[model samples]
Target: MRRWILLAALWLSAVTPACAAPPAPPQRILFVGNSLTYYGNLPATFAALAQANGHAVEAEMILEGGATLSERLADGSVQTALAGRRPQVLVLQERGGDLLCLGGRQRCEQSQHALQGLAEAARAVQARVLVLGTYQANAQASAALVEKEAAAARQAGAEYVEISQTLADLSRHQPDLPWYAEDGMHPGPALTLLDAIKLHHALYGMPEARTLEIDAPRYGANSGLQAVLRRADAAAPNAGTPPHIHYEHAQVERLVRALDHAARATDPAPATPSSAH
Candidate 1:
C-alpha cells in the first residue's frame, strides 16, 4: 500500500504544471511636447503598441500647441506633473525649429538650457530621459538639426533618438506614405507610428517592435485611435482627408505592415556624442 501511494504521488508531481509568475508592474512613461507629439496622440498610440507587444506600459503627456520646452518649464506644468508620480521614462521634444537655431543663437541656447533643466528634473526621480529630434522639410537641414539635438542630448546626459533621420530614410523608399500632416510640418500617422516604434526600441532594446503587426480592427475601435483619426480629418476636411482616415480595416493593417517592413529594412543614423560647445 505504501509503495502504491508513493508511486501515485510521483506521477501527480510529474504531471502537475508549475505556477506562473506574476506579471511585472507597468512601466510609466511621460511625454512633454507640443502639437507634433499630440496631433496623432502619440502617447496613446505608444501605449497601444506596447499593449499589442505584451509590454505593460502607462503613457501620459503634457502638451500645448506650438509650445516650446522653455515655455513648458516656465509654466511649471512639467514640474507639477513630476511631483507625485515619477514616471520610468521622460521624453522631451522642443519646438519644431528651436533646436535647429532657426530662431537664432539666443533662442537655441534657451531651448538647450531648458532641455538640460528638464533632464535634471527627470533624473531627480530616477527616470530615463529621451530627447526626440525633429525633422525638417529639407533633408540637409534635418540632418543638421539632428546633429545639434544629439549634441544637446549628450550634454544633458540623455539618450537621443534621431527620428528626423529615420523618417528621411524611410521616405526615400516609401514615398507614397504620408509622413507629414496637411500643414506639411507636423507628423502624420505613418511617422507617428514609426516614432513610437523607435522610442519603444530605445527603451526596451527590442527589434521586435519594428515587426509587430498592428491589429487594425482592434485599434480602429480604440477611442484614442478614433480621436486622432478624427483630428486628422478635421485638420484637412477640404483636402479630401488623408488616405489613412478612410482606409478599410484590411488596408490599415497592410499600411502598418508596410511601415513596419520599411522600418526594419532601413538603418537609422546612429546616435553619436558631440561637443557641448
Candidate 2:
C-alpha cells in the first residue's frame, strides 16, 4: 500500500502544471508630435491596424502644430501623459523644419535634447521609447535629418522608426501613390496608411500583408497596398471563409478619414508673437 501510494503521488506531482507565465500586459502607446502625427490620425490608425493584426493596443496622441520636442517638454503635456497613462510605448515626432533646417544646428541640438529627456522619462516609467524620423518634401534633407534622429534614438537607447526611409522606398516602388497632402507637408491617405502599417510591424513584429490593409481603392494599385487589401478580403466575415476571422475595412477607412479631418481642421493657426513659445 505504501509503495502504491508513493507511485500515485509521484504521478500527481508530475501531472501538476507548473505556474503558467503571466500573460503580457495589454499594450498602450502614446504619440507625441506636431501636426504630422495628429493630422493623419496616426495613433488611431495604428490602433486599428494593431487590432486587425491580433493584438490589442490603445493609442493616444499629444499634437501641437509646429511644436518642437523642447517646446512639448516645456509645455508639460507629454510629462502629464506619461505619468497618467504610463504607456508601453512612447513615440516622439519632431517638427519637420526642426529636423531639416540646417541654419545653425540649434534645432538639431534641441531635438537631441528633447529625445534624451523623453527617453529618460520613459525609462523611469518602464516604457519603451520610439522616435519617428521626420519626413518632408526635400528628400535629401529629410534623409539626413532622419539619420541624425535615428542616431539620437540609438544613443538614448530607444528604437527609431524610419518613416522617411519607408516613404522613400514606397515612392521608388510605387510612384503613383500620392506622397503628401495638398499642404505639401503632411502625408496623404496612401502615405498615412503606409505609416500605420509600418508602425504596426514595428510594434508587433508582424509583416504587412493583404489581410491587414486599410480600405482605399485609390491606393489599391500598389503591391504594398494590395497586400493589405488581400488581408482585408481574407478576413471578411461576410465572405464565409473563416468563422473566427473578421476584419472591417470600412472601419479602417473611417479611422483614416477622421484623422484627415482632424488634421485639416487643426491646420496650425499662425502663432501670435506672445504665444510663440
How high is each candidate's TM-score? Answer: 0.74, 0.66
Give candidate 1 regions above 4 Å deviation.
1-9, 206-277
**Candidate 2, superposed: residue stretches over 4 Å from native:** 1-25, 101-103, 207-277
Backbone clashes under 3 angstroms, per model:
0, 6
How far does residue 139 in candidate 1 sit from its true spot (Å)? 2.8
What lDDT tens digits, residue by residue, belong to model 1 across residues 166-242? 68877787788777777777787777776776776676533233233432221121123211112111233223322
Which residue pairs clash in candidate 1?
none
- Measured with C-alpha atoms, the lDDT of residue 38 in candidate 1 is 68
**In terms of TM-score, which candidate is strongest?**
1
Lowest summed lDDT window (length 10), candidate 2: 220-229
Prediction RMSDs, each to the true structure: 7.4, 14.1
Worst 10 residues of 1 by lDDT: 225-234
Residue by residue across 1-277, what tens digits does model 2's lDDT show? 9999999999998999989998766587887876676544566556667766567666666665566788877767777777887887888888775655464578777877878888898888888888877675567776786777778889878887777765675577567665676766677766666677656546664323333443312211111211010221122222322223122465345434444343346555532221000
Would you list the C-alpha lDDT of every candidate in the order shown?
0.69, 0.62
